[model samples]
Target: MLMILLAIASACAYGVADFLGGAATRKAKVFRVVAISAPASLAIEGLLLPVLGARWEAGSLGWGAASGAASAFAFALLYQALSIGPMAVMAPITALVSAALPVVVGLAEGDRLSATEIAGIPVAACAILLVTVKRSAGVGRVRPKAVAVAVLAGAAIATQLIMLNQAPHDSGVAPLIVGRAVSSLIVLNAAIAVRRRIDPGRPNLGLAAGAGCLDSLANLCFLLSARHGLLSVSAVIVALYPAATIVLARAVLKERISRAQWLGLGMAALGVTLLALG
Candidate 1:
């Protein structure tokens, strides 16, 4: 229950961060947005360093760096796909793919679920797709090439999550700090490649920094949750973040609420209940 709550909290944090990131992207280039946000997050982590209360051993740092590399690659691919493909398709693909591998790993290790829990897996995954579903037709086609890139991005996200989960219990939040640092560096390189300013302009810069702080906090929540409970459950709960994103859209963006999104929300609640019970 504690782990489930933690993962849900992580999702809330992530959902808000994503909303902010998306808003920032509309104002600036993806790399620039990420570059500013990632470091802003790192700065907060640096401040929290003294109070994290864990031994920062080499092993933890190594795992954190590895996770960050995979995450950076994932972010790059995701941003590329978002730029090229229609978001309705790309968002669901990336979210579902990112959540898929951890479930596979957990099940393969012989974690048993009750009937409802088994049902919840597909239920939750489907909800993600529904939340990302566009009301009207989009311009981009789901080409084989685009699908391939989306899959790769998803795989990268999965790798990052699984690797980050490997951090030893005593490692504390150091993994977040190191992993976030590496990710920030990757974003900087991406900004350089695109010839975009690393630091965004005033309001955008402020927004990115705020979003970064939340993103870092979300990662920490998931990291702590994974260390506390089954990765399968943790992943599923965190994956519900799309629902949160949709709710935020309804509130902040004043986006029209679709019947499908409403149904998706209901399904998500059902899925969460089953998973929590199981």
Candidate 2:
């Protein structure tokens, strides 16, 4: 139950952060947005280090770094896909792929689910699809390239979860923090090399910083949850972050939510409740 709660909390935090990050990308360069966000994340993690305490082994460090790099790559690809693809198609597909990978891995690792959870999987997938579904009057459809990138991003996310699962149980949040910092640096450098620009600007700087801080905090919570519970279950619960994003988009972006999405949100909630109980 505690793990499920932590995962929910992490999902909320991540949803907000991702929304902010996506918003920032509209006004700033993708690389710049990520670069600024990365340092902000590092700062937040740095402050939390005292509270979380440092407990890391060499193995944990390696795995954490690997996770970070994979995440950075995922982010890059996702941004590229978003630039060229429809959000309605790309976001949900990527999210579903990301969510599915850990569940599959967990099943492979002999993690058993209750009958309720077993049913919840398809429901959750449907919910994810509903949340991302957009009603277009015109003839805009999903791009194949965007789908490919989203799939890759999902694979990267799954890899991150798997690596984190392999991290030392007693390593505290140090390995996670270290991994995030390294990943941020790598992303920052890549952005610099590719764009040859580093403009933080005025308002966007603050937004990026805030997004990074929230993201880092969310990552911390996710690591803590994974350490305390089954990785597959934790991943599934945390993967529900997109639900929050959908709700926020409706409220903030004035986007219309379909009847299906409302139904999806309700189903996702029920599924999560069953997961928690399980």
Candidate 3:
């Protein structure tokens, strides 16, 4: 029950961070937004480390670094895929792959699933697709290149989660600190490399920083949840993040939520409940 609550909290945090980051990107260059966000994430992780009582061992640091690198690649590819493809299609595919891969890895690593988990996973996956379903009007044929990139991005995201889960249970939040630090450096370097391409005018610094802080919190929750529960369950619950995103969009931006999305939200709730019960 505790793990389920933590995973749900992580999903909510991730959804909010994604919304903020997406908003920031609309007004600023992607790299610039990432520059602010990544460092902010690092800062939050640093602040949380001492409170979390991290051991900071080399093994944990190595796993964290690996996760960070994968995370950077995942973000880049996801953005590229979104830029080239219909988000309605790309987002669902990426979310499904990212969520499914972690479950597969966890099972392969000898994690057993309860009957409820077996049922919940598919329900959560269907909810993910439904929640991300946007009306892609006038969009041309689906680009194969975009699909490929989205798949790769999802795989990278799965790798990041798996690597973070591999960190020693005793390491506390050290993995998150190291991961955020490495990702921050990478994002900063990317920003510098394309400085000329970034917008020169004022950017949405507040949104970017807020996104980063929320993302750090989400990571911490996911780490704790995974350590305490089955990765299969935690990953699936986290993948339901798009439901929260849609809710926020409706409440804050007054965006219209489709009937399908409303159904998806209900399904997502049901899925999480089943996972929790399992």
Top lDDT prediction, candidate number:
3
TM-score: model 3 vs. ground truth = 0.98
Q: Provide the lDDT at 113 for model 3.
A: 87
What local distance difference test score does each model get?
Answer: 0.82, 0.79, 0.89
Query: Which residue runs does candidate 3 get wrong by more than 4 Å?
Result: none
Question: Model 2, range 197-218, lDDT digits (tens) per residue?
Answer: 6565533887788899999878
Residue 232 Cα positional deviation in candidate 1, in Å, after optimal superposition: 0.9
On lDDT, the stronger of 2 and 3 is 3
Q: After the best TM-score superposition of candidate 1, give how far the Cα of residue 20 lies from its true spot, in angstroms.
A: 0.7
- lDDT for model 2, please: 0.79
Ranking by TM-score: 3, 1, 2
Ranking by lDDT: 3, 1, 2
lDDT tens digits, residue span 121-176, model 3: 89999999899888878667998999999999889888888999999999988888
Distance from true location, Cα of 87 in model 3, Å: 0.8
Question: If scored against the real structure, what TM-score would every candidate get?
Answer: 0.93, 0.91, 0.98
Candidate 1, lDDT over the whole model? 0.82
The candidate, 1 or 3, that scores higher on TM-score is 3
